[model samples]
Target: MTDYQKQSPMQAIEVNNIKKSYENKYALGQPDSKEGISFSVSQGELFGIIGPDGAGKTSLFRILTTLILPDSGTASVDGLDIIKDYKEIRNRVGYMPGKFSLYPDLSVEENLKFFASVFQTTIQENYYLIKDIYQQIEPFKDRKAGALSGGMKQKLALSCALIHKPSVLFLDEPTTGVDPVSRKEFWEMLKRLKNQGITILVSTPYMDEARLCDRIALIKEGKFIGIDTPENITAGFNKTLWSVQSNKMFKLLTDLRSHPFIDSCFAFGETHHITLKNNDLTINNLCRWLQQKGHEEIIIQEIKASIEDCYMQLAQNG
Candidate 1:
């Protein structure tokens, strides 16, 4: 690890009471979106913003990246005000938007050259910076960016982002729409980048990816519900979780929700995740009650809580 990675309390990004809004019909064209969103990232940390579509992830990224100004509140990147230091921030940060923004007609090498030139740097100057990621797609440097596979395109885009050797990297759902294997590869690349002492702030909708980050903030409706490491967040879910499956899933959901002893029930994979209203409720009792309710082929087992489970719990409580 580098000296930068050894710093104990360095903050690379700080956002305070950020607010933004769009026109609202009810308010007679007044702003009507985003309010009081706040979060921060530590230096050399891989922080993740986990949320679904329309959860204000893009708006937050835009504000932090200096692409769009927030209606109110202050955000600083690398200890510089985003508004006053917009130019400096732009030069010191690499932004990989959710969609591929490189020229489709440009070949892999052409795109890299374009970005490098825009930053007033040569590929050789920063070749060592992005060599690990660039080498993966260098063999296809002659191919058009649009002709590359999704995984290859992702790698190329990342290489372009790092061409300038930025201190912070903002990735807005970089893994979305990619295959699972590609997603894994992308994360491995991020880990390598973090190892190089780059502060990475990535947003993703996949709950499973939350576990890979050093810490994650769960966002909903432009607000943060929880922020912690994956293990801590899962550990804080005080409710006992049970996986229940019956012959009829729909009926099982309905019955489970209506059960007096059930606190919450959500469909999780092959089974319904059920939380008890109280610790007094036991698996045998639940099975007997389900059987009495004419639910056959019932299977209930206690299971460890996952980040998804914790997220669902928070969403439900809110």
Candidate 2:
């Protein structure tokens, strides 16, 4: 087994009851925001914070990276207190914000140089750390950053973040707005980085990406609803799940919602996922009911719950 699979008790990152809030009128204006969100990342583990937009993923990243102070609670990275060891925390962590913050006018090589100089280091001194990712865009080193494609820009941003050889890397929604192929490539690069013993903490709005992390914390409205490995999370889903489809999807959702057996029904891709109060509801009965409601071409099947299903269930319960 690899070091990440060992499941040691030693924590590389510890967050204790952290809280933050914006003004009263803001979208995240809850008076008791964050309400003690806490979790830890093991050394060399690929940890993910999975949530939709406005779930406070970015706020938590900012707090952990020491870019912003929390209203209350304490956090430590590599055993260095965030408040007391702010500068040290900055040195030990590489943070790529949600938005691309690199200078658009500068070339890829220049951006790398700027970040390296800011950390008082040389790219050659730590070239090995970022070489695998940087080399893909190296041929365009002299091209302006703004001129690169979305995938290339992501690579450049990640390269700049890692030039200083940080022990922990925090990426906020790194895969957003990229093509599906680019998203796959980005996660592959993360796996390579994880193999090199770097603790990675990433946040993404995409639920499918949760499976890629060694472990994930599902967040919503500034609170963590669940935290565990992907397999465990999906296995822990106790409800009876069914995929219900009909020629009239819109009417199917409405009819299922009013069904006596259904506990919850939500759209999942092309079908509506229905959770029954009990497993006794059979497809024969469901098809007959849909037919009686003037529905045609109805289909129903028992299915396993996915990470997205678990996330939605947790969100509803919370």
Candidate 3:
């Protein structure tokens, strides 16, 4: 076949219309954990699955990492079928679950050595791959895995996952419980790994983390609401949003929700973000209405869109 006709070996991860569900007893009156989900991650790309709790990020990661099977549809890792090549795929992928799943009683060094042994390799053989991460925790090598702090545990878990030298690394909410400094450190480690050409797929509920990935898929209610570069996703927001604040935030929020011109409004940090039904709404009109309602020290200003804003908009529409 000619070069144009030949299939390109680009995608390191491929998920196509996958679906999974549990019995009602397990579901708790919710939809399936995964619903017709589909996406791909290019070779060496750091792809992110951005979603909140119970958004099916874990379920999808389980399927891709060969720990569970999808009820329908298909997925592949390193171009190998998830089902047919489950064994081979297991050897080719590294997965750090959302929760710390390492042996609690084991020391840091033991945990790393155990995982490497299970993969038929030794820490000495692949020590270079995890050297940067392992070195940080090496001083505490004798500490039991369960006794470590959140950030230390995170690094240890990541180190264990990479011991196998897998081509694609799947991290499910790796930074969920870590402190701000540790979260920042964890992403820096990911960036270094990415530079080494390891394909990384991470999922997180924190919208701020989405910007760190090369591309992100915003998942909600067991489906993708948006998928693109962080910048592009923020740019795709079509409405004019404003930051609103007042001396009485609670009262201001209630009043804003009651306004007929408000399209969507939600508390964002110290301020509330609201979009109008149309761009024709004027700040003066809102200020006048709020003033009449006894609101004081009202502050309203148009603001640039953020990933959080985009996710909120999608959740509202879908």
Candidate 4:
């Protein structure tokens, strides 16, 4: 409590050994997550938690936003203790939950005003805070929140979340169901907000979006397999990858897995991405084998490792 920010302005959020369990199936952390969760977010930094559904992202967000308490461990938001200063933490941080929790009956403008009023603030006072995002949806201000398009609703939710001008913002899968264009626009808004010195922690299931963050943590089953800049994580992949396609694609996965040199193989879109046990292996060796198996129009080429590829390797190891 000795002027935390003044002492360490770079550290905006700190979480240590946080753990939560549900008595029923709706639990955040399953038995495997008993080791606890730990991570830190820097001030004004764009941090991302990348993972698929049921990865315990929502549970982690709920615990940080103070909507639900962790069974154990500790965390601080903007230097205030999550447990002892839940109220202060709530007021100082903006949280857009994965689900739409806004009022359906209220008009878009009405909902924004309601959220602003909750903190004894007004839309006018925070107009500059969310101006860029709000202007996109202002034309439909009178439309009922329930009737808005998916993209528009996300914009409004973001506006409401920013109306209070929080120092730290937590967005849980803000682009989950949004269209490609909306997702692009949303990340642009986050960059502008980051420039204004607001720390952001966003979660997304899209691996493509991982590169947009300053730093990211690749999460799976309530645990982090790797945490680093996107470039670093992919760069660490020291394996020879190949993209392969053939006329008989149905059995391609089984055939590739059967290959003695194949270290790993997974179907990706229309092609199978595989890595080799020996980097010295040649493509002709694979081509001749497929030809003997009666496969036609076989195409194989080397490719670079992507964030998804890195994740696949980690998840497979465990």
TM-score of each: 0.92, 0.94, 0.94, 0.94
Which model is ahead, 1 or 2, in terms of lDDT? Answer: 2
Give the winner by lDDT.
Answer: 2
Show where candidate 2 strays beyond 4 Å: 1-7, 25-35
> Across residues 92-205, which tens digit of lDDT does each residue of candidate 3 receive?
999999999999899999999899999999999988999999999999999999999999999999999999899999999999978999999999999999999999999999
Candidate 2 on 1-318: residue-level lDDT in tens? 334346667799998888787764222214645457888899889999999999999988998999888877888998999999999999989999999899999999999999999999999999998888998999999999999998999999999889999999999999999999999999999999999999999999999999999999999887888988898899899998999899999989999999998999999889999898987678899999999999999889989999999999999998
Number of the top TM-score candidate: 2
| Prediction RMSDs, each to the true structure | 3.9, 2.7, 3.7, 3.8
Candidate 1's C-alpha lDDT? 0.89
After best superposition, candidate 3 residue 23: deviation in angstroms? 0.8
Each candidate's number of clashing pairs is: 0, 0, 0, 0
**Between 1 and 4, whose TM-score is larger?**
4
What would the per-residue lDDT of candidate 1 be over residues 78-186, giving only the tens digit for each residue? 9999999999999999999999999999999999999999999999999998888889899999999999998899999999999999999999999999999999989
- In candidate 3, what residue range of length 10 has the lowest lDDT sum? 24-33
Model 1 segments more than 4 A misplaced: 1-8, 25-35
lDDT tens digits by residue: candidate 4, 1-318? 223213444688899888777775433445655567788888888999999998889899999999999887899989898999999998999999999989999999999999999989999999998999999999999999999989999999999999999999999999989999999999999999999999999999999999999888888887788888888889889889999999999888889999888999998899999999996678998999999888889999999999999999988876
Judge candidate 3 at residue 181 and give its lDDT.
99
Model 3 stretches with alpha carbons more than 4 Å out? 1-9, 24-35
